[model samples]
Target: MNLTLHVNSEQETLDLAALLATLLEPKDVLLLEGNLGAGKTTFTKGIAKGLGIETVIKSPTYTLIREYTKGKLPLYHMDVYRLEDVGGDDLGFDEYIYGNGVSVIEWATFIQDELPDSYLTIKLEPTGEFFEGRNITFEPTGEHYEQLVEKFQKQASEEGLI
Candidate 1:
């Protein structure tokens, strides 16, 4: 299933992500696609917040993967942009992707071949109306992710967030 949501400000984006975070489970994989300044990390920060993570969230661009285990479930944040040139075959990503936590990958296309069979892909784009405005689309590749999106849409609507 696919779902799209519009947010007029940064806070709205964070709120929406936090809402979705509450519905996630272990082994849930979220692929974030966007331009350089599309707020991918910001959305991740919200997910960390909802997951009860207390430390600051930073982009894993250089480090590749940053694991936050203090949250309700460990959050494996990965930035695979660098893999475009080097490849990702030796990263052992499966350990985290199928681990007892949620995995959020930025620039996932670089590691397309390494991805699992199912996941939720989130695309973020600038609305061009305001600096912080964004149009977020959720695309699910499996029944579990489909249900996750459904619950997220329903909860977001009930909370007047979408």
Candidate 2:
């Protein structure tokens, strides 16, 4: 299923991500797609906060992956943007994608084939009409993910976070 939301600011994007983070479970995989300034990392910071993590969340661009275990569930943040340049699957992606932690992958399309059969995807794009406006699209692949999306949307609507 698919759901879309218009985020008016960076905080709104983070709020949305936090709300979705609350509904996530161990082993959950979120594929994030967007441009350089599309707020992917900002959204991830919110997820880290919602998961009860206290450390600063940053892009794993150079490091490939960052692990935050202080939260209720471990969060494995990954950046596969460099995958094309360094062509290989030796990074052991499956360990984290199917591991006992929540995996949020940035630029996931680079390694889409390595992802699990079921996962959630978030696509963010800037809306040129308004300043700080972002068009966020969600695509859930399985019943579990679909239900998670439904719950997030419901909570977001009730809290006026959408």
Candidate 3:
């Protein structure tokens, strides 16, 4: 299924992340897609917050991946922006993607072939006010993801996060 959201500000986006967080469970993979300044990382910060992570969230542009726990579950945030290598074995993708935690990967397009069969992908774009507004669309790949989206949608409606 597909869902779209128009965020008027950064806070709105964060609220959306919080809403989405309620739907996520351990061992789930979230593929975030967007251009620079599209608020991919910003949205992640909100998700981490809703996940109950205490540390500040920042884009792992250079670090490749950042792990945030202390929330409902462990969050494995990854950014493969600079990855020029693609080895089915060395990537150890299953370690995190299939591990006992929630995985959020930025620039996941780089390793599209490495992604699991089931995942949640969000594509973000600037609608207006440049960096002030964002249009994010989510796509669910399986029953698991569909349930996640439905749960988020229902909770968002009840919480007015939508």
Candidate 4:
């Protein structure tokens, strides 16, 4: 089942992402879909924190990809937004996606053909009631992600965060 979470502030969004980060494992892929300024990078920073990464998390918009290996598990952060025009054929992103790390792809729609058969897609949207309020949905494409979402839901419920 898919999991939907509500957050009223930037911190809440970060905290929620951090909670989900705890359940991540190597080779896990998370596709982030949202409009500009939708907090994708903020959520990613929280994941880095949960993974024990000390380095500052920045958007890979210009760099295309950023590798953070100081964490318990490496994080391969990719922003495919720029690839919308050129395409992602020769980027060799498969190495990161299938590597011994968690890969988070922003603007994933730009590289849909490069994605694996299974992964989790996170969609964020403004709630309109509050400036910082957001509606986050976790859509799982396979068994692994399904279980991940299930565990996250249970944990968030127990912590009274969702």
Candidate 5:
């Protein structure tokens, strides 16, 4: 199944991401595609919040991967934007991507070929300057992802998150 959401505020976008945290399991990967200021990291901030992570959530653009254990489950947040000139493998991103946490990659389009088959794909595009509105697309690539679609859609409907 596929799902789409239009978030009108940065908070709504994060709420949606937190809803996803409830549905995600270990080893789940999310390949986030978007341009800069597209809410990829903002969406992830909600994931951390939803998962109960207490540490600050920031882009790993320079660090490659930021691990957070304060959440319900571990979250491996990665950013590959700076690596367009470098190689993903050189940074050993595969290890974190395939690890036991929920790996969320920002600017993941840069390394699409390396993405796993069971991952969920999220595309966020700017629709306005406020950063509150977005054109979002969700594509799940596995049975686990199907559950994710069901859960989030139901959550959205129940919470009016269209």
Candidate 6:
């Protein structure tokens, strides 16, 4: 099933992402797709906060990947934009994707073929209503992800974050 949400501001987006993060378990993968300033990193920061991470979360645009292990479950944040220009698959990304942590990949389509059998894909699009407005679509690809999304929807609704 698919769930669509309207993000009114950065805080609302972060709140939704944090709520989703709470439902994630180890080995959970989040595929983030959006434009250059579409708030992918901000969402990841929210996930990090939900995971109980205290460290600063930065974009891995140039570094490709950043690992934050202080959280309940480690967070592996990856920006695969460079992969498109470099064009190679020798990074051994499976290690992080299947690791004992939650993996969030920005520009995931860059390595779509390398992804595992199941993962949650979040597409953020500009609504053009407000400077921070966005129409976020959550597409769950497996049983585990389906449950996760359901729980997120419930919590978000209860908390008025949806």
TM-score of every prediction relative to native: 0.97, 0.94, 0.93, 0.97, 0.90, 0.95
**Collision pairs in model 4:** none
lDDT of 4 by residue, 1-162 (tens): 888888999999988988888999999999998989888999899899889899999999999999999988999999999999888998899999999999999999899999999999999988875457888999999999999999999999998898
- Tens digits of per-residue lDDT, candidate 1, 28-139, equal 9999999998999999999998898989999999999999999899999999999998778988999999899999999998888889999999999998755558989999
lDDT of 3 by residue, 63-158 (tens): 877888788888888988887565334678778888888899988877888889999998889986657778889899999999888888788888
lDDT (C-alpha, whole model) for all candidates = 0.92, 0.89, 0.84, 0.93, 0.84, 0.90
lDDT at 12 for candidate 4?
A: 94
Model 5 lDDT tens row, 1-162: 878778788888888998888888888899888888898889899999888997989999888788998778899998888778765665666777777778998877677777787889999988966666897899998888888888888887897776
Q: Where is model 6 poorest over a 10-residue stretch in terms of lDDT?
A: 84-93
What lDDT tens digits, residue by residue, belong to model 6 across residues 41-141?
Answer: 99998999999998999999999999999989999999999898664388889999989999999988788878999999999887785556988999999
TM-score (C-alpha, index-matched) for candidate 2:
0.94
Candidate 1 wrong stretches, greater than 4 Å: none
Q: Where is model 5 more than 4 Å wrong at Cα?
A: none
Task: Write the residue-wise lDDT of candidate 2 on 1-162 in tens digits.
Answer: 799999888889888888888888999999999989888899899999889998999899999899999988999999999896664377799999888999999988788778888899999999875447999999999899999889988999999886
Backbone clash numbers for all candidates listed? 0, 0, 0, 0, 1, 0
For model 3 the TM-score comes to 0.93
**Clash count, predicted structure 1:** 0
Which candidate do you rate higher for TM-score, 2 or 5?
2
Candidate 5 positional error at 10, Å:
0.8
